[model samples]
Target: MRPDLCLENAGRRYGLRGPWVLRGVDLTVAPGRLVRVEGANGTGKSTLLRLLAGIDAPSEGRITGRPRTAYVPERFPPALPFTAVGYLTHLGTVHGLSRTAAARAAGEWLERLGAAAYADTPMARLSKGSSQKVAVAQALLAEPELLVLDEAWTGLDTDARAELERAVAERTAAGGSVVFVDHDPRRLAGLPDTTYAVRDGSLVPCDVAGPLPSGPHVTVEAQGPPDGRLPDDVRRTAASAEETGPGRYRLTVPAPHSDLLLRALLTSRPPWHVVRVAPRPDAPGSSR
Candidate 1:
C-alpha cells in the first residue's frame, strides 16, 4: 500500500530573511486522490507545487512520505540535448524500469500523446505544443505514485488535453495521487477530490459546493478475484462500492472516472470481470 504524503506546517522562502512564499501549509495527499491547486498569477501556486514535488526544500517545517514522484513544470526546458525518445527512455530507466521496458513505455506514451512522429526529433527543434506533449509523456511513462503538474495542459491541443485528463483519471484509479494546477476554471471541474486555493501565502480549502453542478455518474457491476477481494485502487476510486453477492460488487463513480475504473479492474494482476455498466438515471443531464 502506498503511504500518504504529509506536509506539516510547511514553509518556504528564498533566504533566511526572504519573505515566505508559502507558510503553515498542512496537507495530506493519500493514494487514489486527485488534488487541485488554484490561485491567481504570482500567488505562489507554482512554488507550492514545486515544494510538493521535492524540487525545493522548505525553509521551515517538514514534508514526509513522498512516494515515487514525477513532475511537469510550467515551463519545460526546450534546449535539452537528447531526442524526445532518448530523453524519455533515459528518464524511464532512472525511474527503475529496465532499458528495454523503458524504451517501450517511452514509445507508448509518445503515441498516446499524439507525438509519435516526433519520436526521434531533437527536443530543441520541436514546436511548443509538441514539446509540451513530450513533457507530459516523460512524467507519465514511469507511472509515478505521485504526479505533480503545473499548467501541464497549457500548450497542448484539444485532443491531447483530453488525453491528459484520461491519464490523470487512470493514475488515480491505479492508486496513485495527482496534484495539479491549471489555469482554466473548467479543467476537470467536477472531478477533483479536494481543491485548495493559495491565498495570503497559505493553503485554503475551497468550498466544493460552488457554482458547478455535479456531473453525471455511472454504475458498474463487477466480480472480484478468486478470493473475492477487490484491488485497493478500485475500492478507492469508486464513490460507493457495495457487495451485492459473494464476490460480486456494484460500484458507482463519476462518469469521467468510470472508464479508468473498468480499465483498472481489467488490468489488475488477478483481473476483475465487469458484468455491466450503465448511466445513473438520476444523474444530471441523464435521459430518463
Candidate 2:
C-alpha cells in the first residue's frame, strides 16, 4: 500500500545560488505511526519539517502522497488581531470546519490546554506560554491526517506539555501520522515508531533503545538526608534506580502513578527531597 506521505530524493535550499540545506533525502510516513526527527543546530530540521507540512516547496527532487497536514512552527506569531478563541475558530474554518463547529472546538481545546480563562483575551495580550497553547490548539483543531510539530512543546507548562503528548497518542491511535522535533532527548520518550537524524544535509536512520515501559513514564531524581530511605513500595515498582551522589538517587516511575511515588518519598518518616522530575530518555541510540 502507498504510504501516507513520501519524500523521494527530496532536496531543499534557498535563493538560486544558496547552499543546499537538505538534499537527496528519502523518507516515508505510514498511517498510524509517530516519527521523531533530531539534529543539531542549523542542520535543516525546521526546513525539512516545513517541506513535509507543505509550507515550503522543495527546490529539487520530489514529494508525493501529500495528506492533509497541520504544522506548529517553533516560533508562533501571536500578534494576530483576534481573541484566543477567535483565532483558533478562524483557523479551524480555514481547515474546513463549519463556523459553529470551529468555535466549539476552539473553546474545547483552550480548556484542555488550561487556557480557557484566556479564551476571550486578545491574542496579542496573551503570554508566551498562553500563545503556545493557542498554536498547539490551532494545529489540532482540524484533526489533520498528518501532524507536524516543530518544537511545539517549547513554551507549554507541565500539564499542557502532557496534554500535547496525549494528543499525539490520540492522533496515532486514530490511524493518523505524526512527526515532531524537540530539543528534549526524552520528548515523548520511547514512543516513536521510527526516528531519523538530519546530519550533513541528509536524513539518516537512528536506533532508539526501546519502547518506553508499557505506560507513561518519568525519571525522578532526588536528594535526601543521609539517613533517609525510599519507601519500599517505590523501589518495588520502579523500573530502575541508582545512587547518583552521596545522598542522591534517580528513580523511574510510571507517570500516572508518579504522584503516589513522590508523595511516598516526601511523606516518609524522614522525607526524601525531590530534585528533578523529567521524561525518561530512551536508551542511547546510534546516530551517524
Evaluated with TM-score, which candidate comes out highest?
Answer: 1
TM-score of each: 0.84, 0.75
Q: Supply candidate 2's per-residue lDDT for 288.
A: 9
Q: Give the lDDT of residue 144 in candidate 2.
A: 85
TM-score of model 1 vs. true structure? 0.84
- Which residue pairs collide in model 2, if any? none
Residue 202 of model 1 has an lDDT of 96
**lDDT string, candidate 2, 1-288, tens digits:** 235698999999899999999999999998878899999999999999999999999999889999889999999999999999999999999999999999999999999999999999999999999999999999999898999999999999999998887777667655688999999987776657789999999999898765344545678888877755655545533446677787688887657446656776777667788899997545322110
- Candidate 1 stretches greater than 4 Å from native: 210-232, 235-257, 265-275, 278-288
